[model samples]
Target: MTPHVPALPAMGVVALLRALLKRPRRPLPSALPEIVTEYRLDRLPLDDIARYRAAFGFPGEHIPLTWWYLPAQRAHLAT
Candidate 1:
C-alpha cells in the first residue's frame, strides 16, 4: 500500500458520508454496526490547554466541545 494513500477510495468515502447523513427529524437505526473508532490525544500540553481555555473560556478540565467530533467522524468512517 502506498504510504500516502488511504485504503478506501474517494467514491467509497463519499458514499459512506452520504449514507451516514440524516435529517434531524429522521429516526436513527436501532441496530448499529459493531464498529468503533477511538481517537486519543496522548497529552494535552499545558500551553495548549491554557491557550484553548483562554481562547474559548474553558476554565478547567473541560476540553473544547468540538473535540468530540474527531472520534465521532472517525467512527462514521470506520463503520
Candidate 2:
C-alpha cells in the first residue's frame, strides 16, 4: 500500500507571494546516466561533465551526477 501525504493549504495572493519569496532555490540535478558518465563508472569513459557544462553552461560544482542518464540510455539502446 502507498502512504498518504498531506497537501499544502491554499494561500491568499499576498500570502502566496510571501511564501514564494521564502521558498529556497535549488538547482536541478542532472539526469542519472550523466552522473555515471561524469564519474567514469564501468568501462564506458564518456565525458558527461564536460559535455553538459559545455552544452548548458552550468557552473562546475552545480552539475549533478544525474546527467549520466543519457549515456546509460545510449548503452541500453546499443544492447
Candidate 3:
C-alpha cells in the first residue's frame, strides 16, 4: 500500500499577520525614474498644424488641454 501524506493546516489571520510582520521589507532604490520629459513640438509626430488639430478630435481654432504632452513615451525612456 502507498503511504498517505497529511494535509497542512491553514494559517489563521493572527498567524498570517505575525508572519508578515516578521518578514523583512526591501529598501527602495535611491535614484528616481525621470518622468518629466520636456514638452517640445519637435518630439511629436504631427507634421503640420492641421495634423495636430486632427489628433486632438479637431478642436476648432484652439489647442485642447490634452495636447500639451509627449505623443509617445519613447523619448522619456531614452533619457
Question: Model 3, 2: alpha-carbon shift in Å?
Answer: 47
Structural similarity to truth (TM-score) of each candidate: 0.28, 0.31, 0.33
Q: What is the lDDT of residue 12 in candidate 3?
A: 96
Candidate 2's residue-wise lDDT over 6-71, tens digit each?
998877899878977895588666665543423345654446576776787766655556676776
**Candidate scoring better on TM-score of 1 and 3:** 3
Candidate 1 C-alpha error for residue 36, in Å = 2.4
Cand. 2 Cα-lDDT: 0.67
**Model 3, TM vs. native:** 0.33
Tens digits of per-residue lDDT, candidate 1, 1-79, equal: 6578656655777777877995578789999989565666676566765686787777677767766665568767865
Top candidate by TM-score: 3
Looking at model 3, the pairs that clash are none
What does the lDDT come to for candidate 3? 0.66
Clashes in each model (backbone N, CA, C under 3 Å)?
0, 14, 0
Task: Name every residue pair that clashes in candidate 1.
Answer: none
Order of candidates by lDDT, top first?
1, 2, 3
Model 2 alpha-carbon miss at residue 44, Å: 7.3
